[model samples]
Target chain A: MSRSARSFAVAGAVLLAFTGLASADAVKLGRPALPEEIKAWDIDVRPDGLGLPEGQGSVSQGEELFQNNCAACHGEFGEGVGRWPVLAGGQGTLTSERPEKTIGSFWPDTSTVFDYVHRAMPFGAAQTLQPDEVYAIVAYLLYLNDVVPDDYVLTKENFPTVALPNRPNFYDDDRETTEKAFWKATPCMKDCKPKVEITSHAAVLDVTPDAGKEGDKPAGAVE
Target chain B: MNQMKPGSRVDRRRFLTLAGLAGACAAVGVQPAAAEATPDPDIVNLPPWTQALGAGVNNHPYGVPSPFEKDVVRREVTWLTASSESSVSFTPLYALDGIITPNGLCFVRHHGGEAEIDPTRHRFMIHGLVDKPLVFTMEDIKRMPGRTNRVYFLECAANSGMEWRGAQLNGCQYTHGMIHNVVYTGVPLRAFLEAAGVKPKGKWVLAEGADASAMTRSIPLEKAMDDCLVAWAMNGEALRPEQGYPLRLVVPGWEGNMWIKWLRRIEVGDQPWGQREETSKYTDLLADGRSRRFTFIMDAKSVVTSPSPQAPLHARGPNVISGVAWSGRGTVTRVDVTLDGGKNWTTARIEGPALPRSMTRFYLDVDWNGEELLLQSRAMDDTGYVQPTKAELRAVRGVNSIYHNNGIQTWLVRSNGEAENVEVS
Candidate 1:
């Protein structure tokens, strides 16, 4: 599509014309999505191995990468630094008062570990790692969380074989069925309760901030 | 421009009056007769601007809020997060009126940080199970057919998370500022997905961001087809930088975090991805140790803004108690206000026609006898979902997790006319 022609086609794509089709018959507005562009992004990995890229990495390589890049915030053992996320152990702790929901402990899929590390790992500097580096990191995370042995070398071929122990623990949202009693067309209006008493006060929590003029503090700034 | 200089000390009452006058002028088409016949001694006297002509138009290629209204802005709850980049800023809810939160003053909440994106270099790619894989440039997205303008609220799942255990935030902004309502103008997600032609196996869609967090979430195909939008503009203008600038996903009525900012990619698949965000972060941990995943819909909720901790009653006698009520399931059918807490209640008048999955302005007037009162509001939606109390909410889902705390809020007003955040049982 030519530049001006593309603009004209897009002009038709404007907001008002969108009582759009109910199905995918295609309307030829934007150009066909290219394979190279999809390949550059298309980085998501699903539990069924549908989106995993062709790559292979060893746990040994991942250990070196993990120690150099991840240990600072995630802890040397993926136990997590001050408030950063913990990536390793916490097996069998889901029911505990403070469950450690690390990648291995509570995550239901290994593909999630790969997808997350590849796209958003190394904290501030994301999407800067190579495919093999991400795969290696995933391997090392598995070794840390006891999902795989130290000798395990992950590849796209064997990706679906590994699964987290807590995979079956999840269930789809059932709010409609579970919370039916909460619905009331005509709610209780007055004197519904015998008496009401103060249970808590925010002033006692001592967490609210003092409001000041703008430029007294930065915009879009939180304390 | 007869603008007050920045940092100049002007009485708040005086500013409010001036702003109200300016607003009235703008609304009523500047009738000279409406000006006060005689300037009151208390009001600021007309300055040099009345004597000399102000700067001509186009002084600002892009305009900004009036200098006199500078104080109306998003504020930060300093102790909420570790750093400013990955933190939140609350809207000046008390200062705002009606349902639409101004574009500049809308609350901001980011995960990793704002991705300073360059539009020319940015594009949205849709792949996976599709007939024709496609990528859209900023212009391409704008040109796409089936553009829609829908109004909805984007609420952080943790909007009232601080109050899960007990009342902790002093202001309505802090407790509920994590939500904002806007009319999003964009192409429907279904249009884009259908343009690419979905394969029969595609059951879920993963929307990904371009920020440092590269925030991603698995949205069900049913929702992707229902009302989701691939939005570029908000409230009729280009999106603000803090609001994902050039392009962002608008998952109406869902938790705000799923409205991925700086949206980059959408991949269709057969099953839920269970990414770190869904599994590790956004999931709710229940009392029985089982966790509830994909709790997307924000339940019906309401809050009294005028008598909040930050917005205290100024004088005794007749005062209109006003606030906003909204629901994710459908339109807000009713909002009941209680002056003496749960003991007595009155149905507040809905200001206008209520819309589904959007904010509704509500008002209730009461005569002040100067007695102590507990101000509370209860909202019910078309789905018959009545807003739950804090005690009712806590009983079902323990305070183990912070997200999805949509409980009815309470404000205690003393005879002195000051209000404080409090919980009543």
Candidate 2:
């Protein structure tokens, strides 16, 4: 039995002893999951190409798809529109004041682009792209980032070979080793700090919208 | 906001000293305002509520808050996101009391946008490294073995994301509102994975949602086996449409985004998927250029809700200053309130159940002298991790990463009873 179930069983046993009435509320349920339903929903692709569906598409085909579906939110060259994520470029800019993390710059594996595009590209319309279309759009994104040649065509075989420039930049979490000091048995209480000066204010930055502006009422007024 | 009349500040001492006949007037019947206000002849007859019979039951099939509470709704800062569809609305923290956030008052955060998923057509699938690949309909899943009632706080990794740079938001609603606590009714995810029989080599489980973003995150197998749950009902009723009606993953103590809404797929895998959320968006950029990936656990945090910018004090005598304190790692054992900034700290009274990974309400009823005060709350959890200051946090993490900011927030209360968001030394 799982830990949660084991705990529940103990609680039930205790309750049964107390009442002595024998409540038969326990009922086992749920049927085995179907294979066809699994196939339809299991669309994730790992870095080792574990879940990449069989597909092939050229850069040219992906370019057309990008313009038709993606360009409205992601700019013509994958610069990003409004606050939608930027897909390409931002190479060698990780150390800059404002790092523009994009496919060519920060992402490590090629499968992320493939899996993300296949399942959730074009914003509002997700999971609409076919396996082949996903391959094409990913290939076109690579072309935009200068990761591929104009004649390049991505396939399930070649997808594993394409790696990002910033692949070596990421590392596993090291909070236990790096932030041990944060774990304190007893923190300073009285006069912990002699004086705490005022450093900044929200009004100074002017990022927050004015609080009492009744002009723009909520769309669905509960009242 | 029933402060004594202008000249009554002096009379306040007299009332305290005398315990006088005015107490009789209060004994008869009097709202606080009636204690002092000079009654007008036209209005002294009867108030609207006293004059007429109130509306009957079923006036609202599902009831709403009083019309007087119209302003107590979730609000979004216009500058936070590009569009409302792919945006977030903060919970009205200042206007709330206690730790339990009502389903309607809970905050909303979406990526590609809020989706209206029909449960009839919705299906949840578990595939990849498993002995038996499985799929479940809403009904199929609800019939599972156990329905555990667990209360956990779901805080977005970016709960106070804006503050990493500085005190950029005015209210606690905006500053620390990307969170909610609730009782979940569902089976443990390990039970379903066990039924399917996870392969020995399955090191990770990539959970995917069905929204426009199809939000996905890779949970390590150990963590998945530990506390993760596939919950359907939140706070008793069916999950709100805004909260992924049919199903959602309840990852206790982890960042909110990982608790995938409209949950549809869970694929057991041998390695981390390195999805976009873990890499591009949620990753933390260090001062030296290296970025920390998969920084999932939300650190210990707390905030003073009342006497905040939106809910300022009008009455200065005896008042209850309350707020919430929580830790992703464990239960909050103690919460300290600092009336004079960080100089002096006193342990506040913790109220309600102190459950693991759940919010605990703390309060300190104080006699406000109506002086300029710097208010702050510091929380310490079972893990012995005390909530750090904004300075200490910034010194280590720097101001680059806009996530996982569990620093102490300070609210400046002026003599005139208005509070503004501010930072301290």
Candidate 3:
């Protein structure tokens, strides 16, 4: 068949389907996602504690797990490795020149610790452990932050009870006060600010069109 | 090219910035790790200027930006807000290239907190106004045939949130670093919604993340059908943990909050959910004291990365001033570079291929006379919108808020070739 004829035929079928059979036939096309399949990948632990898993672990178990899995990057005490995020030491430093913002000091919720650990911790190897391991890791994180007792065990059952240290520090902004102060009028029309004038120009690179310039020497060659 | 006499201050600063190269000269014995197009630096072995190795084996399933790129990372000032956690961090949009922002270098902002989730037993349930009320597993979703798109860019409404008041930060990394672009692979939301069977009246959807806070947002169903994606991979790999590994919602050209990470569930609804993220946060304020609720799209914006405050002007002669520009409304058409503040604008040579909703590189070839000059860039999108200046933005949005500031940025280049963030009135 000619290309235009094929296109016409396909268009007719699409129009027919859209007008009559589109809604009815659409239901049968895709299969229902299985529960087990869902369970295998549904790892979220919501702020309202809707998806907490069934296993449990104590602070001691958590500490052991953290040391085994998280300490290298987060720091042994969650001080955070190098530029890695500091998790434990930023207690009450929110107002200082440099705030610490550790889990104990800055995090607004206890569940975030649990959620982050179970989903993405131990960096290179994700989704390798059981639910209990995640709980234990959370407990250990809490213990390190002094948010929970050393002997405390974190379980799905009591997960929501653990409160983060900086819980009350969070607030919502409607930005009403800010809008009146900014972003409300038609922007400037005339001679705005000092008119930007170009004094000189430089070519940083010559990557375009592969210009064989003298200074465009490839990196790593002997000078 | 203009030649400078010896012992000039401009030459001195260039020497200091390249002081590390002195070690490279000494370590000529150092072997290039990989022989790509460019001889790759021994990035893996060198100590990052910032991060140390994280604790435990759990340091990072996906590693972060290298230390040398530390100067290219996010920056936030305390005076920008009361608490650092509540304030914003800008991405070094000017310094990065290609579409992918390494997981470590991706900018992060949170209202409640960052959630940790284990993906092995993860689940996603679709209820509320759905015909089948189905649930999906990660394996199931992955098994289903999905599409991979090499589109780029995801930005926060508050990316330049601080620039509205003034050029508070000293670098382009801070003023315009909140945006990033990358190709992603995932199931299309339209396909997922079709499979789940939306009800006759389903008009909006609420996406929720699994982290402890369960971050949630409501998105229009039409927008979902338009181009929304449930992403599982970024730059051809599994999602970075910090970037919502396992699963996330990708709403291109929209505010970052709607692109939910650590995505947990999607509830079909006939009306907007009015969640905390949408109502209390992410909304824009107007000049008359009325808040602009549901301001979904981002405006056109650009920044000159090189010769920027943090990157600095290395020498006075010939300098290549480069940076990135993008718009959520559409593609960037042109970028104007101004050396005397915002006076006479020169059309910058837009390099690299431009893509819709992706970062476009712009370059200006200029020779410096070793005198003080104000550096600035204004981006124009395909839709014919020019990037607004700081005062223009303040006239419309007011200054009390800290979000959606897409104003033109200024860098003060001193006689010594040092650049600092400055507001030009």
Candidate 4:
């Protein structure tokens, strides 16, 4: 055979060997995740009513249930007990002397109130409440926020209708501004705050060592 | 390294080989002889990882803390301490070692469960009390100049808070367990605060997370400019999904609560927002009716990890006891180990490089008498502040508090080479 013909034969043999190896190594053991499986795991409801399950709850039912199950910890009217999260009223306080994170004033999504309750709530026993009970709680939360009347019903059909006050306040953060303005700024490598000006090293502020505590034992003691 | 005798080496080899086989047998469901006997009362044995394979793959790209570590998690005994879903978990710092807390071992405290945030869609917004209100995408953060430092020990204020009065939990994992040390990489918070051009009136800055809880906290602007780091990496890799993944707040020496995870927003403000986390949950209660708030920095502390409850002494002869010592305030100057309780304290030899806000390993060379003895450690920070005794701690702050208890810990060593949690009053 001619040299060219021999080379072609060698290449063909190599290809056949690799193809056989590939087929031999193929192990189709685990099945690919189906869309339904993916959907089930990814079922997270956003505050804006994204991904809410199909169901409905009335504010009155929510009010009665919230009083019994949630009031002890969350307080009556969702004001929040002790240091628990505030569920109602921080309206227009974003600019106030002291702002609070309340369900009505700070939360950017109504769907979040529903999602959190449905998945994990009541401290120890999470996800025990029925779907309607979750809806009633969400409705009660809405009533506390004054977003809807006490009689308004919260369900999958009308869940997306309710809006949050802080929705506009929560604009997507743009770190680019930081990059251009600060990260790219030439570091003060030369005159970097000469001496680290001690504005306040108060005992409460003394984040460093207390004093004389470092290397207290004789230096050569370890050896 | 100090060399020992042939007899000891043989014992060690046999012990390690047997230990390995026992571990293997346990993995395959052959319970060891010791396992059947009520697991050592003092020693907590972690369950095998392969046992709980419920609802398999892609169930959690990253798994939750081990069921063994469940009790070591952060919990809110009361609600209203945070809004309905917002909460926190304590790190079992006392049960970990070598400075890297396994991802499965790290504690989690959250205003909400792990925020299902997609880095592709996530954005960070800076507004309020700033000359300009701007927004940045996750890509923008990557483009920014960042630095990495291997700092150690970021603790929650509530670490060991339970032990303020008397020892509530029997082990160090419960008492002084709410801290973790790791290398962090991030753009300095100062870089961002300076970029925002804080209005002169701006005094405090609030950071918010993107989870269902939408957690937020206000930090003093001065502190932000001083040494705060806006971290994106932990232990040289991207933050774990549970640990804020793409980005988190790093306030060295301060409580972990302020280090918001899955950070999305920072709003400069004139004063603290007095959020529920700060007022209701983190604050320490005093007998005087007034609560102690803003008790931020963790005090100096040290503990003997080897002869500790979980890790008991194996051989009785000359034992090289080792442990980790750290201070949120600064470098550990010295760690004194007391083998005979508080009666005599010999200065422990710090072995590794002692960096500020980092874990410093210390070792004590002492012969084991095969007798019951009390082992304790006291840490002295660079500032000459010695870790207080349990009594001193209870004296300064009444027992009603549930945070920042940095008292000296005692471990009772029995003749059999086992250790137990103890109190030295």
The better candidate by DockQ, 1 or 3, is 1
For A104-178, candidate 3 gives per-residue lDDT tens digits of: 765556665665566555564556778899888888888887778888988888888888755564444433343
User: Candidate 3, DockQ to 2 decimals?
Assistant: 0.05
Fnat for model 2? 0.64
DockQ of each: 0.40, 0.35, 0.05, 0.03
For all predicted structures, in order, the TM-scores are: 0.85, 0.87, 0.59, 0.58
- Predicted structure 3, TM vs. truth: 0.59
lDDT of 2 by residue, B21-105 (tens): 3333223222456668787867777777788998898899999888999999898876556677778888888998877889998
Residue-level lDDT tens digits of model 1 in B144-202 = 76788988988888788767778877899888888888889998899888888899999
Error of 1 at A108 (Å): 2.2
**Residues A1-223 of candidate 2: C-alpha lDDT, one tens digit per residue:** 9999999999999988865431113322444567776777777787888789998999999999999999998988899886667788888777666667788987888888988888787676788889999999999999999999988999999888888788787777777678788888888778888887888887775556554443322111000
**What lDDT is obtained when candidate 1 is compared to the true structure?**
0.80
Model 4, which residues run further than 4 Å from truth? A1-65, A72-223, B1-96
| Residue B401 shift from truth in candidate 3, angstroms | 2.8
- Candidate order by TM-score, decreasing, is 2, 1, 3, 4
Each model's TM-score for chain A is 0.77, 0.79, 0.71, 0.69
Residue range A38-69, candidate 1, lDDT tens digits: 77777777778777877989999999999999
Reference-based lDDT, residue B147, model 3: 60
Spell out the clash pairs found in candidate 2: A33-B135
CA lDDT of every candidate? 0.80, 0.81, 0.66, 0.63
Evaluate residue B67 in candidate 2 and report its C-alpha lDDT on the 0 to 100 scale: 90
- For residue A166, give model 2's deviation from the true position in Å: 1.3
- Runs of candidate 3 exceeding 4 Å displacement: A1-223, B1-90, B111-113
